[model samples]
Target chain A: MDNVSQEDYLTAIYRNLDEAGEIKPNLLASKLEISNAAVTDMLRKLSRDGFVDYQKYKGIKLTGEGELYAKNMLRRHRIWEVFLHQTLGMPWDKVHDEAEKLEHSSSDEIINLLEEFLEYPEVDPHGYPIPDKNGKIKKSKTVVAITELNENDTAKVIRVNDDVKNLLSYVTKIGISLGKEIIVKDKLEYDGSVLMMIDRKEVNISNKIASNIFVEKIK
Target chain B: MDNVSQEDYLTAIYRNLDEAGEIKPNLLASKLEISNAAVTDMLRKLSRDGFVDYQKYKGIKLTGEGELYAKNMLRRHRIWEVFLHQTLGMPWDKVHDEAEKLEHSSSDEIINLLEEFLEYPEVDPHGYPIPDKNGKIKKSKTVVAITELNENDTAKVIRVNDDVKNLLSYVTKIGISLGKEIIVKDKLEYDGSVLMMIDRKEVNISNKIASNIFVEKIK
Candidate 1:
C-alpha cells in the first residue's frame, strides 16, 4: 500500500473478519482505536479506490483486489517478524510492533529476499501462518481458545493473539510459550478466569487473555 | 529523528558538508530536491531544536548533538545497506534506495542487532564507513576523486558517492565498483573528462561522474 494508514486498515479488516468474512465499522474502529467517523471516512475512500465494498451502516467486506493487497501486507509483516526473531535475535514478544512499522516501510523485493533468507518459514514468531508471495495461505489446524478447554483437559499452546497489547510479554512472564503443554485446573464462574497448570506451576489467566490464546487439544 | 524528513535533512547536510564543515542552504535544497523556502523553514525548526547552528544568510553547521544524531542515522543507513547487499544478496546499486526507506523505519535496537548479525561490518556496500554506537567514526586514509588522478596514474576505487541519484547503477553498468583498480590513460582538457582502463577495457567517464568516484592512488 502507498500509505501506511491505508495498509494498516486493510490488514486489520482482513484479520478481524468474522466467519461470514465481514466486519462492522464499529468493531473496526475499536480494533484500530480510532473514531467511528474516521472509519466511515476511510471506508468511503477504500470504496472509491475499489478496495472494499461499502454501504451506509453495513458490514465492510474486502473486494478481491483488497484481499490480495491485505494478504501481501500480512506476508510482509510475518516475514519481518520471522527475520526479527530468528535472524536478529529480537524477542518474539517484541517482534510484532517492530514488524508493524517495517511492514509498511519494506518493499516486496525486500520481503521476498527475507523469506528466502529465513528458509521459507511456515509461520511467524507469534505462530500465525505466513501468506506466500501469491497470497496463498497455508491451511492450519483447527484450534480452540484456552477458555473453551474443560477442567482436566490438556492442550498445547499454538498461537497467541498479537493484536492485544503486551499479551505476548505477559504470556512469556507466566512461562507459557508455543508448543507448551497446559492442563486446565479450574474455571472460575465468578471472574471467568482460568487456572491452568503450566510446567507444573499453577498460573491464573483472565478469561479475556485465555480467549485470545489458541490451543490444540491433546486430551 | 522521529520524523523521516527531519532525519533525511540532517543526513543530507551531514553528508554534503565541505572541508569547512558547513553547507550553503541552496546546496542543501538542491541535494534534497526540495524548495529553498522549505529548507529555510525546516532549518529554523532544526536550529530551534538545537540540532544545527543556523542564522539568516550564513552557512549551516551541525551542533555536537546534531552530529551525534546524524552519525547514528548514518550508522543505521549503512548497516541496512550491508544487510541488503551482503545478506540478502541485493545488488549494491539498489541497496541505497532500499536502505533509505528502511533506515527511518528501524529502531536503534534493530540496527544494533543487524550490526551484530552482519558481524560488525566496517563499511557499507558503497564503501562508506559505518559509525560505531558511540558515534565514533573510524579514521580513513586520504582519498581523491577519480578526476584528480593524473594521466598514467593507477588507483584503487575506495568509495563512490551514494548521494547522487542513479550514480551507483551507472557506475555498475560501466564496470566500476569498490576496490576495482583503474589506470588513467588520458585526461581531456576540453570537457575535463578522463579515459581510464578498467578490466582490460578502456572506459571514458565524464568529469562530473569522475568527481563523484573517490579512489586511493596505488601507483
Candidate 2:
C-alpha cells in the first residue's frame, strides 16, 4: 500500500513478536518508546486495517497479511543495513539509524539493484538473516549467549540483542564483530564479569553485556 | 547548517568543479540532469546562501567558505559510499544513490563513527578520493581516457563519467570497477571498439562505452 505509517506499526509488531514470541502492549510501548495509550491506539488502527489481530488488554499479533507486510519491511531494513555497513564502510552502530530512515524510502528498482550489487547477501552486519525477495528467510535458530559458554569454548560473534547507541559504541570499540572468533576463559561469579579472548587479546566483559552477545561455535 | 538540500547542492558543485576545473551553469545542469533554468535558480539560491560565487554570463566557483562546505559534504558522501559498498556488500553503482541521501542526513557524530568503522577509507567505490575529516584530500590526478590507450598500456579503472542506470549495469557486467587493472590489447579503428584484458579475461568494448571510462595509468 506504501502506507509508511501502517508499515511501521506492522514492522514494530513483527519485531515485538520475534523477541517475545507474543506481542505485549506494554512491551510494544517500551520498544517503540511510545506511551501505552499510543500503543493501544495504534493496535486498534492496525486491527481495523487488517494488519493485526488485537484483543484489548490481552495482546496482539500480526495477521497472515500483516506478517507478510511486516516481513517485507524487515527484509528491506536488514538488507539496507547490510548494504550500509558492509558495502558503505559505515560503523555497525551508525548503520541502524541511517537504515531506519532509508528502508522505508527505497524503491523496488533500487533495492533489486542493491541486492545484485551485494551478491544477494544472506545476512546483515549484525549477522541477522536477510529475508529473500519473496520473504523467505533461511531458517536458523542457532544463537548462543556469551555468558553460557564454558572456559576456552571458541565461537564467532553473531548478533547483538539491542540497538542502544551507547552499548553499540562500547562493544565495537573492543573490536568484536560477526565472524570474529572469541574464546571464553573465565566467568566471575562475584560481579557477573567474564574474561574472554578476542582477536588474541584477553578482554573482560560484564554479564549483562555477555548475555547480549549472540554467537555461534567455531567449527 | 546541516540542511540536506544545501549539502546536496554543495556536493554537486564540488564534484562538478573537481572534474571540469570550472563550473558552468549549463555543465552543472547537465551533470545534475536538471534544466538550465533550474540550475540558474539553484545557483542564485546557493550564491545568496554564501556557498557559491556567480557572475552574469560568467562561470561559478566555490569560495573558500563554499569550498569548505563542499569538501565537507564530499567527505561525508565518499566515506558513506565506502561504507555502503565495502561493509554492506552493496553493489558499486547502487551505493551512490543511497550515499547521496545519507551524506546529508548524517550528523557529525555518526559520520565520525562511520569513518572509524570503515578504518578511514581513502577512496570511494567510484575511485574518487575521499576528503579527510579535516577536509584535506590525498591528491592524485592522472586522467587517461579509454579512447587514448594503446596496446600494452595498463591502467586501473578509476570511475565512470556517468551514473546512468542501464550504463552502470552494463559496465558492471563487463567486470570494470575502481582499482581494477585493465590492459589494452587491440583497438578496432573501423568501429572504434577496444579489445582489452581485465585481470586474465579478454573483453571487447564499444567506443561509445570506452569514452566514458575514466582511468589512471598503473604505476
Most TM-score-accurate candidate: 1
Top of the candidates by DockQ: 1
lDDT of 2 by residue, B76-183 (tens): 888878876786677777777777766665666667877887888888887778887778988777777898898888998887853555666788899887778999
TM-score, candidate 1, is 0.98
Task: Looking at model 1, give its docking quality level.
Answer: high
Q: Across residues A1-219, which tens digit of lDDT does each residue of candidate 2 receive?
A: 666667777888787684545788887888788799988887888889888888888768788889888888878888778867776577778778777777766655567667887788888887778877777889776888998888889898888854555677789889787778899999998998889998889999999898889998876
Instruction: Compute the lDDT for candidate 2.
Output: 0.79
Q: How would you encode candidate 1's per-residue C-alpha lDDT over A1-219 as one tens digit per residue?
A: 489888989999999999999999999999999999999999999999999999998899999999999999999999999999998899999999999999988999999999998999999987899999999999999999998999999999999999889999999999989999999999999999999999999999999999999999995
Candidate topping lDDT: 1
lDDT of 1 at B7: 92
